[model samples]
Target chain A: MPQHPPPRPGDERTPGRAYSARFHLLDRQIVTEDGTPLAKADDLELIPDSDGSLVVSAVLIGPTALAPRLRGRPARLLNALARRLTTGPTDHHARIAMGHIIRIGAALTATTPPVDATLHPLEDWIRDNVIAPLPGSGHAPG
Target chain B: MRLADLMGARVIDVTGRDIGHVSDVRLTEAAAPSRRLPGLHVAGIVIATRRRSRLLAYDHRPVDAPWPLTALARRATRHALWAPWTAVTAHRRPPRTGEPGTVTLDQTAASLTPLRDMHAHWNSGT
Candidate 1:
């Protein structure tokens, strides 16, 4: 590969704070405006632009994004379970639009509000059918 | 396509020769927004000589640690190649039988930027 020097401090078009996607963004915890932890940014959605380049369209969060990154039988099991539970073969990932990103630091903060945890089918399933019915499960800790 | 789909995909030249694996992606900061959503543009993809199964960001910035930790990271990312998105062709999925996915490059390896030099250039300004 041909070697090219990195951009200097005063170089035009260089970001004020340069960030490598992996170093700065990937797998970061995504929090909402109210500081509620939503999810980790499991994957990125890149949309192709007319100029033959790509732009980060959104940050993907959820099991749909995580299963693919996992290897072996565990991945297979998760894939099977997710497929069986979904309404249909939908885009399983929950996307947080790039526009909602307010800041990027130790953790990412977005304008989007925290999703209701009850909306998670698996969590709902476990709560309604499994946990709620058990004895002494209704009350909170002292 | 999702970043997961591209990460670890095989990079090939016009002649269909194996180049390397997609190691990481590079993004340029989007212009400051005014009542708009902030975003980033994909500038390039980093290709490594080997498939880096583990995720590490040691390659992008310089490290000055106690000892071998820095040395090991430098060696790990020694042969990284930065391929600009402009040189990228179509992102073809279900790449012909043997390939998982293919990152088709418009030009040869000569067009890629070496990682070490990029780090030097980045540090020079600081």
Candidate 2:
């Protein structure tokens, strides 16, 4: 058997490198260019290539993408609840297209906006209804 | 399809013998058209005979870490196998209620490369 040298930490960021999806991609935090946290990469969208090999298409975020990974009764309930909360006819997880990704390091950086309505509908609702009603909520604290 | 759907799918050989379950997916940056970030192509699937928690990458990577822990991980994944993506003849079936999906391989389990030997192949950059 041939022996190979150990890979240095952070080597996965190197272009054209081979990486294990579980270790390098899944569960990694994703952020926008200005350093605002978006969401963790809960699941990956894989599309078949012309040769029938799978290529990563996008990073899938939110509960709809995560529930299947949890895999059980709780997962089923969570999936059902997420479906009900979703507003559109096509109920699907929020995805950040691979084309938008700028870099993959400790966190994946993308050109996507900080806040997306589809990404966090519940959070948006709470801010608009509950938080907006509070006195002095309009201004950011210094 | 989602990568989550294939994560825990059972691997079956051409003769219908159980091999193992997919432990992790291996990807390589390969050139492809119509992509901004370099395309991550599916390279292979890591299959382990026993249903253990994450391999922690000790099976393939050279991690001489905090002594005993590294030794334990190496022992745990001794029987793991590496099946190239080309060997996979079928994608996973839609998961059933409380059951995992299945991935069928055209080759037999014995013909697959051992996980321990994968590092060399990966380093060769083939």
Per-model TM-score on C-alpha atoms: 0.79, 0.85
* Best DockQ among the predictions, by candidate number: 2
Task: Kindly list the per-residue Cα lDDT of model 1 for residues B1-126, writing each as its tens digit.
Answer: 777667667899777788888777877765645213235777778888676533267666667686797787678777777787888886665332223566899877766787766777666643
Off by over 4 Å in 2: A1-15, A134-142, B33-38, B96-98, B123-126
Error of 2 at B111 (Å): 0.8
Name the candidate that leads on TM-score.
2
RMSD of each: 7.9, 6.3
Q: What is the Å distance of residue B26 in model 2 from its true position? A: 0.8
Candidate 1's interface RMSD, please? 4.7
How far out, in Å, is residue B67 in model 2? 3.9
Per-residue lDDT of model 2, residues B44-67, tens digit only: 899988865567766446445788
Candidate 1 clash total?
A: 0
